[model samples]
Target: MSMDTRNLLVELFVEELPPKALKKIGDAFAQTLYATLQSQGLLEKDSMLTPFASPRRLGVHITNVADQADDKQVSQKLMPVSVGLDANGKATPALLKKLNALGADESAVANLKRESDGKAEALFFHSVVQGATLAEGLQKALEDTLVKLPIPKVMTYQLADGWDTVNFVRPAHGLIALYGNDIIPVSVLGLKAGTTTHGHRFEAGLDPVFIRHADTYAEQLVKEGAVIAGFAERRAEIVRQLQEAAANAGDNLKPIDDEALLDEVTGLVERPNVVIGQFEETFLDVPQECLILTMKANQKYFPLLDADGKLTNKFLIVSNIRPADASAVIGGNERVVRPRLADAKFFFDQDRKKKLESRVEGLAKVVYHNKLGTQGERIERVRAIAKAIAAKLGVDAKQVDSAAQLAKADLLTDMVGEFPELQGIMGRYYALHDGLPADVADAIEDHYKPRFAGDELPRNAVGTVVALADKLETLVGLFSIGQVPTGDKDPFALRRHALGVIRMLVEGKLAIGIDELIAAAEQPFGKITAEHRDALLNFIFDRLANTLREQGYSAQEIDAVLALRPQRLADVAERLAAVRAFAALPEAESLAAANKRVANILKKVEGEVAAKVDTSLLKEDAEAALNNTLSTVKPQADAAFDRGDYTASLQALAALKTPVDAFFDGVMVNADDTALRNNRLGLLATLHAAMNRVADISRLAS
Candidate 1:
């Protein structure tokens, strides 16, 4: 290390931060401080930073920070020579005024540099600017960094004086700013720089952990404060303890893998102590999901699961303090959680007393939307759409109708009212308990499948039909009222709904056409305008194009296939595959360019250009040769297309590359002779139709 530079440390000790936002805020605080200091030349080129975040504090240690920045040389452009100087080449009044305003004088005119400022010669002022001292620079950096933090919410609290107040994420009690062993003297959130900070509220060996040097902050806090002092270190320790505890519980047992919950728990404790607790096994009669969610969401516990992925009666608690005997801690946590589990069991038992059908009538009282009427009306629309889809797929309509009718019935149940996320799940359980058919019961739950990106789709044919119908009704109904998604603001998740529709049609390989399905969904709405229908169709295709891109298809491939607006989304994957294969052929480039030229030529004709070519008008040998080639190749390509061999169909067009080049090279498409021009247009029209059956190959042109 250089004698002139030393590592710097800054710490802000505050009350407990919001666990979910601590990681993000800590990262931003450290990074922004480093960036601001670097911009001011207060740091050496090789400087490195280590960020620290815990429940009670945020800090950073930076190496090779300088006490003062180096002097900088700067050049300032003045007014044009004509405006600032006289023809005598002496300093004019205007020039003297500019020089005086820049802390210069007429005596320095001889030292002024002259350079061309774009269009004219202009005088430039040059000076050596003094660097910033560590105290002022550090103060500015602290203030700027605090303002840029992503605080979820701010609390206004009174300072010690009881008259002044400040807003911060949490009430700050102390601040530490150290450059080597000396205090750099920076302050924030109404707190002045100091070397003492409190650690664990009750377990600290020292009332105030006294930091001696910038390099010894973490070690001192751990030794005297009874705190881990680093967010990552503390989290890793928690993970290790959780794993060890789960292993000791039983073989092949593991805590639920939820990174979000782990982070929240880590933020809740400065020193973590993992302990195991259990509930009565009889409470397991309720669904595992309900029990697991109650433990994790309500109490912030990690529920253990066995090798078969079934929930066990055991759960793990991450306490803030470690004691010699932990039986009391375990007993206290288990006692606190018993009533929560009892409430869940009670809701489950009460919900099953009346069949799901009984709850269907209560939905009429729940408003779906001001314009769309109630949940009861929406269910009718879903049923109609589902039945229509079933009819097209040659499936049993009765099952689909029953499933769609009861899908939203769980919303009124006690369990679902307590946890909205369990809506579809509870419906399936109640339906089965009511002795409904297996497929129908499954459909009631699966209708909400594929809830997010990469989520699984409906599990069976019945589920698939209802899911499509449900998503489609949501899309058309919202679109009819013009509640479309704009930019990143998708309050209704219309984009997700659209993608779900695409997934079932494409992934499920359903025979239903997208346009036909949209029409069927719209039928229940009664008299939707043609403009709305077209708008909804365009929206669906737009979503499909985006999805195809995410799946690694190139923009050209997606555009070419989607441009045709293929009604059957199931055929889109095959068409894209064919386009990709066709693009690889040596002749693909020439044919694509030729196809583009042909489209442009046909677009210019005043009237409709018939596809019927007149062979007698084919005067050029190139045109006649092209005509003969098409007759031999068209039937083969058409046969492949008819049988759904898109790759074969596209590959068959490769033979026309040579003849197409010749025709475009030698033929006069727009001849002065009207008869000849129309005949050539007719030929190009026929060629365009033949080439575009799979995709518009012209889009592949660079």
Candidate 2:
């Protein structure tokens, strides 16, 4: 098991590649090579494979490839086609069909057999096939390897490119494929193999590099004043230079996570160098988010920080080349960033003075959709529903009203107008400027905090109220507008909004009735078609079902409780959680047997017979006793519900288990007499009424 240190050279040279695609394409190229080599069984030992790329080229060098495969037996099996044919001692047409299917030339097959099933078998014969050389085998295997390679984006130049499409990300200018010291000719896309590789476009004495092996690939490119390698190396070099420049000037710099910036910086340089630039104090007046976005989003410059956590006037700038005079680059960078910050500062001041309330009227002018009415109309519906949600939560009604009114007002603000990402943040700033209560202002901002899944939930009661109102209006409006979500498309993100409403109620411990509020919000959809109403209800509930699963509730658990009530989403969540908890108790397994027995009896007396029992007709002692106890417990259970003591209500219902089991064992529910049937049904009806206070007990899983 000797390690063969054979050098493998591979390169794809083309037009300058965008930095964004280089790292990804380089990774994909390396993976394809490893996967292909494994499939061909060429590299049996552990190997070192490294990928390198620049604006115009991507290459790889593999170190520990197997010198050669183990020599073993090559079994070849092919019988004369005439051997398995008809009884006649002849070469049949069936034999011809078999040969054609195997891609053997018809003339190549000898029409004779030696010994098969005596005389008839004797007509057929077989021949041995020779195996080819390992190098030839390797060449065939590697030739088809290019088809499996995936390039991120490609562009066509002259003749063969990566794929035969309209155009690729960049043209395949030249390629270098070498196996050890020898050239390996394998045609990929349309390009053939050679040892010639190009160097830095600007240098290298006007001649392309002629590298015999991959080990020298990187070294040759470096000598030509080009760094054709990894993103990490380039990134580290840039940071090192930037920090050095910053430290000399008594300013500390730190690297931030900006993958897009890192890539653009990679493409901006063959060799990266850095400098620090500063601006005036007036720019700090803008919001932290605005200033960060201005620097990171616009200019791709790293920000400088002071000893305090506050931002400084300086920024770190990375340049492709180290200019002889560094001040020229620094001066150029400050000029670019200053205008960006000035625009942000101007947008901040203009937005601050304009009150949120005055802009509320302009929302109606903005169309949420041509069919779904104006933003103003949507706000009116949200306002009406917010009051309902607030009342359910026992929140301050005045604050709820104010939040709904101003929530969408920031849509017209200059800050929100310029930065769509700052919608709710602007609302909070504007709310404070208007001298509104702190609770309402915080709600206006926090309502949209969790704009996506796994995002933070509302922080305050007011935010929760507005969030519910906003989701309900959307569910009702979309259903009313006949634009319900389907198998794929949910253009409105209605599902996220609905899940947000459900999650807030159950997880946030808010007690609210979903159906009642949704129906109230549906008031504005009077013009809705009947089709829309039915479809919307199903879509809304389906989204709720999905949300329930996401929150870790099982299908059986949800279905067990959902059948009882449709109005209270939060209450239903509580009931399911309690049921699951109760089910976990050791005694509950025994309790389930009694429940199953009760369920079986109830299932028998479903439709024909009434459920309420007449005390006079309770002929059996157990039936009579159970009926009396239910009468006593009914008033207490009703009282527990009024006080929101659900746990006590559940305990009260469990009291019926002994008597229910006794009644089933003693009396016959289906008797011959019509009078007896009616009497038993009446008794079961009374028992069901008591259980209904807990849940639709019939719907609870056995």
Number of the top-ranking candidate, with lDDT as the measure: 1
In the range 1-702, model 2's lDDT, one tens digit per residue, is 224447576777767877766777666666677656655455655677787767777667776555454444432234543444456644457656665675554564454434545434333324443333335444554454444446565554556443454345676677777777777666654667788877655545325777746677777676654554565577677767766765765645454546677777776566676777888987886766778767877787877665555677777887765657989888989888888888988887888787889999999999987887899988988888888778777899999989999998998987777788888887987798789989999999887756888888888988988888888788888777667777889898877877787678667866556656666677766645667766766665777777778879878666656656556665766677666765555545444565555567767764754656667787889988788888877778778766766556655666676777788789887888888777876777666666665455444445
Query: Candidate 1: deviation at residue 233, Å?
Result: 1.6
Q: What is the C-alpha lDDT of each candidate?
A: 0.92, 0.70
Q: Give candidate 1's TM-score.
A: 0.96
- Cα lDDT of candidate 2 equals 0.70
Model 1 ranges with Cα > 4 A deviation: 1-3, 90-97
Minimum summed lDDT over a 10-residue window in model 1 is located at 1-10
After superposition on all C-alphas, the RMSD of every candidate to the true structure, in Å, is 1.9, 6.5
